[model samples]
Target: MNMLHLPRIGITPDINDLPVPETEYVVRQNYADAISKAGGLPFLLPYHEPVGDYLDVIDGLLVTGGLFDIDPALYRQTSRKDYAMKPARTNFERALIEGALSRAIPVVGICNGMQLLAVCLGGELVQDISTEIDGALEHKPDQSASIAHHRIEISGTSRHLQTSAGEVHEVNSVHHQSVLPSDAYQVLAVSPDGVVEALEKKDGGFAVGVQWHPEYGVADIDTIIFETFLSKAREYSQKK
Candidate 1:
């Protein structure tokens, strides 16, 4: 396919503080490379209020992970000191996701992005897995992104089973927070330690979130995720 014909995927950027008292919006190169490899054009979206305008231009949305947390209050939870947040980014992403869902745009959330997605969809998060869940595996394992930290059992009823080769797959985990099981969305996968590893929208419009950083491409399942997301984006583009 021509490069111009590739589905345009809007990727949310991480907001970082600069020493000069300003902020910078940045998207990791891995995300762009992964999107390209999956046959989609990655477009980094800045923090802005006009989410509808951004949604109007992109065929799909990829809410990338970041080293931050969503405010507990957003999900009706008490604040904890261990929680680190970037309110600006969270606010923008929340609006962007709401707008995307309203338009039936495909959305793929990664790590922190997944947490925020849960909150946006009337679900809550386990603020800190280590404290909240007994015997929870070390989720934030300090290792290279390419290294597998643990295994997650894919739910047979999940759409992920269509892309995943088997019921269980090794995945790299890097988040301290995990999504709580809720009726608002379908729990797609879970770690042996019982933490939620992946989820999808029940309404079935291609909304999926995985706790692992699939953009790292550590395993075949990672590639399948990007491919499936881009394929959906392609379908959306054609519909438009």
Candidate 2:
């Protein structure tokens, strides 16, 4: 049996207007498509109160990019800089991640999702790119609105069994805030700047996070990331 592709992804809600009224919750499309292309079943997990119960059944988790920020209060901060673009609560993110790690489930956090993963793992965020970098970056590389924005270099062997070191992957860059002072996760890849572009769990866990969005227009979708994540999910499902 194919034992490395059963994924039940959990997506987060953004600040966009949702199809439902009163309580708002809507998942992104590209994220689900990416998992589907990689041979995994995607579940659009709505922003809810109790997510702990679902952790046991989920094989893998995909934290996606969106137009919101995690409550900075979680990091013990009061300065509200870009509150408009901040993502919703998603308080269940860390719990889900820890749950996955405990059961040996694969995780792939994209963009802000990546940042949250870092924070959950005792890492700090850079907060504002304008303050961190000297010059502005062309976050939107493609004019067509369908291509990945920037480039990233995968420095070491990823959790994905197939990807080799020194591989340069083109990803869509679409955020102003990022994670900095990352210690818990291994610096897997980086962009031109000293800013970390990608990170992997150093504890031999099958998990990775990328600052860029690959679900939109990454040339090789199944190359390493989705492949490794799905493979891990399949493993988790089989053990059940």
Compose the digit string of candidate 1's lDDT tens values, residues 43-113.
99988777888998899999999988889999999887766788889999999998888888999999999
Per-residue lDDT for 41 in model 1?
92
Off by over 4 Å in 2: 1-5, 15-20, 76-82, 85-88, 140-145
Compared with the true structure, what per-residue lDDT tens digits does model 2 show for residues 1-240? 455546676665564555446556556677788788777898877665566667766778888776666666656566447564443455667677766677667788888888888877778776677666777476534464356666677676665646666776666677777777556778877776766888878785678888877776555743557777777777777777
Displacement of residue 115 (Cα, Å) in model 2 is 0.4
Best by TM-score: 1
Alpha-carbon deviation at 62 in model 2, angstroms: 0.9
lDDT of 2: 0.70
TM-score of 1: 0.94
